[model samples]
Target: MTDVQELSDWAPDWLQAITPQNRAGLQVPDQVEDSRLQTPLSQLSQSNHDRDDELKPPKITNITVMPSPNRMVKRKLQGIHLFMITVNGTLGIGLYWRGGQILELAGPLAALLAFLLVGLLSWAVMQCITEMLCIWPIPGALSVYVSEFVDVELGIAVGIAYWFSYSVGFGALIATLAAEFDFWTGTSGDKGIDGGIVYLLIPVILIAVNALDIEIYGLLEVVTGCLKVACLLAIGGVLIAVNVGAGKQGYIGTQYWASPKVYDRDAANDWGTAFLMCLSVAIYAYMGVEIVAASALESAPSARWTRKTSDERESQLAQTPNDSLIGNTVRFSAKYISLLATISYSLSGLLVSFDIPWYHCHLPRLSWVDSTANIDCSDVSDSIPANTTSAIVAIAVESGIPHLADVVNVFLVFTCLSCASTNLYVASRVLFGLTSRLDGGKGQPWHLRLLSWFGRTNRYRVPLRAMIFSAASFIWVPFLQLQGGTSSSTSIGMFIEILAQMSSVAVVIVWTCQVLAFIRYYHCIKRHKNVLEQQKIPQLSRDNVEDYSYRSHAQPVLAYVALAGCLFVLVVANGAYLWKGFHKFPFLSSYLFIVVFVAMWILLKVARGARWRHVDLSNPDKVVRKLRKLHDIRLAAS
Candidate 1:
């Protein structure tokens, strides 16, 4: 008899019933099964019977008893770690440099408005993510949700694009670090140590940190995240002090905003166009905020629930309060971090606008511009060394606080390092998620079979291969400095801008997919409400149906709003090329990801002959039934 037939003969009914075709009914979608699917009871029974003849347990038997390879990412992150990472992931070098870029692109008020608008979109995206996370709480939750609820092709596309975005962002961080180091050491092109050397070292350090236990990474993020918050606060205080005549230029209140030249008339003719153009920059600033959801795979509760036997999991659930679940923590963290990010970004824009004239930073300065009331355009020189100093540092210098500029530069280095590490961590996990599957299973498409190599983990339970690959991919970004040119600073600035724009586009696309996925999930839940109610799932029970604990407020309305916002930003922010007459480089950088995304979707569709699985109303209860089983198990265990 075939092995499958033989196994089925002695397998328990539960084991016999489990198959890929019907896994959706069991509430275990193929993607979730990729991580937590246990070995069939029959396999264990057969292994034990066969091993009885051996004097000791065979090595293979021990391997069989271990958790699946995909579940190996250690869950060491606690509630505090999640909260801090959520905050820190989005808080990075962008905050340091992006303010000046946006203020230069759009005037102060337009920049402030853009930050607020994107913040609302971020809120909606996080709400959708948190709600879905409460239900699945799986590793690589973002792409997995897209794949499960939406379609596999789109999920693959989003996963790859998101991973690419982080990878590219990591490169951008490295470039920023080199720029900061140049500023700190008073070095530039054809000068002191090569920036490329610094680039090489940063990634090595980040890889080492990520390679350690996840808890250590979490702790590091918490510390750096706190430092980042403190840095922002200090900068804010300094800005306020400078605005009130503490600096060389006294009583600088609203001087810049009141100037007719405050807005960049060259960039955009109208305030509205300027606002639209800067949306991508604002979105880039908020890119990493949703990483908390990505890190949910390693969360303590999620880990505990996934690793336990059904009975053990049930017992634990019986004792644990529902509110204490990872879902609640994720929801709280999302809300807290989004609010914090918005306020911080808006205030930074507003404060910077007060101290420095938008016209002052209109042209990128290679070296610090000194504060002088009578400074003329003729005094501007192109010979200053290129530095990665923020507009805030320029403000400090212009305020006669040169020492404060140095301190801010130091903090900027740390911020870049912290953010680079987070990017690597997220990218590796996303790549790992993309390649995860059952051992020896043919579930993944042939094109992706080679990537399965990165799916494995070492004894530390980290996806070491994937981590190494991700770090290595961005190593070339810093080498751009090696290219000899008179306008090296301008080159670096343009490179960073291109990366930011492309990454921002990728972020919006991912957000759009996520919001759409949530919409589908929302509808699926509604269609299956009766099944869910009958199953007595607390979150969806008859009494609690309308007031689901983890449900995001405003339901479908907020989701649609988020969707519309993402689409608007994706099209409008990148469409500047269309109006300005397409420059080859800008046009490519702006919409290249979209072209890549569409191409990928088509390739996968053609390769796999897959079709978009429209809302499967017929099996609407599949997800609901799965939730019911999970709830029932938890109750029984309790």
Candidate 2:
């Protein structure tokens, strides 16, 4: 027997945590009490969690995941809400928190341009993801495609890289909350006492929100997304207005940019090093974009659950799952994944460059408690270099807005909260999608069966159990981070590399993995076309190349450029860390990025056997073909 079956008690009751209790009967239609599915709510209210355990589904030891298809009348979240997913994912704390760092790395002008460059590159990368997703629309976008179209072992590595990246990111998010409070009060609160409270609340809130139904998640994101966009717009407008002599500090236009050192390098020789480090910092600021592709399965209809196959029902599944909501969601997913973040980030960068000087910063100190004093940047020698947090504070102070900096700090706090929630949301879903396919259709091993326990979703279809399991990292890792709480030696801060220069490595790795997967996907398509032409075979009656939804505008060109750009960023992102000498960083900090990435890949390879499992190029996945058939009849009739 394989190791999975031999250890029956390994993480027992893990899958059972879905909606209190889960079992065989949970798969039965009548047993599933999806309150949102049965009828539309007249007045939307928060999902009540108290009654989730009332239904007693019969227990079974074995794991069996069924396809969940939506019938015509049952769903929340029109395409409009699809934008919420991507917006929430991309508009993270990085843009608001890193202004100070950007100013310090390079002058505001170069940093602004660098940030804009990263946005463009990020959009390019998302385009590649969009091309794959529009074709597949499967859960766990990159990993699923890589596993199905590329190789199983390689796919697993990519998926873990993604999972681990986001897992560490949760700590990064928590670390920021303390900083947010510090900025808000203009004084660092008692680290041990107050930090303890946030550590307790952050995970509980995320779990509570994510554990509920999809509608609740969608609603929360929509509201939060709107507020975040508003905040960005208001701040951007204020910054622009102030630059034109509208503030206490008069007529600042481009003066900061033309100041003594537009760039941070001392010598021409070190210019190369400074530029690359700045570029990496800019790129790392745009992490958390994968939520769009990661949540694609949930945001759009994959039709895993459907009525029994019959002439009518089968025909229904084949014709593009005709609903305006799904149509709009699909369309919006493509547009919004990069649009909101790109515009906001670019504008924000320009504003920061205009308002803040490279050297002096008025950002709150770590132990500051004064609310009624002028911030003197000239005297402070050990001030935290201007990052996004300090940038906002500096801009507000310059604008002559009373307590505006504190208000913006509060907004930044919400930004972190929303980001960590999104991370937990996607992390849980990725783990669920992987374990759900443990008993793979055409490719898988015996040991995979053991992990199937992490695969199930709750009755509300929220991946509740999987989400809770993923939240285990929050219990200790973030708690340690809170202990340090903006002090000199923050907990888990070293591990995540947010304080260090390790931030962009994870983003680069994820982008490269997906682009590599895209290359394989491209090969599969051509290989299929070649086989069809040689065999003189007719296209399947319900199949249409056009039916798979949106085709990426540029085929391999977009993907290739994206891959090259990401690889370049990866090599250069760590230049700052390297300057201190590679030997200085042990295992815990930013340097662990490469080590963790390679080690995880090797470990997965050994577990899968000596060699990787290469997907058969001659035959693409059945699900891919099935999805293409969707809208086929619609296209035929048109």
Best candidate, lDDT: 1
- Tell me the TM-score of model 1: 0.80
Superposed by TM-score, candidate 2 places the C-alpha of residue 548 at a distance from the truth, in angstroms, of 4.4
Question: Over 4 Å off in model 2, which ranges?
Answer: 1-76, 184-188, 191-193, 246-251, 259-261, 265-269, 301-318, 321-328, 362-376, 379-389, 440-450, 481-483, 488-504, 530-545, 579-591, 610-638
Total colliding residue pairs, candidate 2:
21
lDDT of 1 by residue, 214-233 (tens): 88888988898888888878
Angstrom error at residue 531, model 1? 2.0
- Local lDDT at 229 for model 2: 81
lDDT of 2 by residue, 1-638 (tens): 10111111211222223221333432212211211011112211225564354344523233222233210112455455667766766788778756556666556665566677787778778777776665444555577667656676767777766766666666667766765666533344555544556666767877898887787778888898888788878878777776776444445557766653444443112545655666776765677665666665565453322456677656656654333124335555664566667777777877777766665544322121121232446544343324334577666665666677667777778787887888787777777656664543235455665566566666676667677877776446555644444543233444434433444576677788788777876765565664333222223211354344445557678788888888777765544536534434322244567777778777887865757456656543342332233222111111
Highest TM-score scorer: 1
TM agreement with the true structure for every prediction: 0.80, 0.75
Q: To one decimal, what is the Cα RMSD in angstroms of model 2 from the true structure? A: 12.7
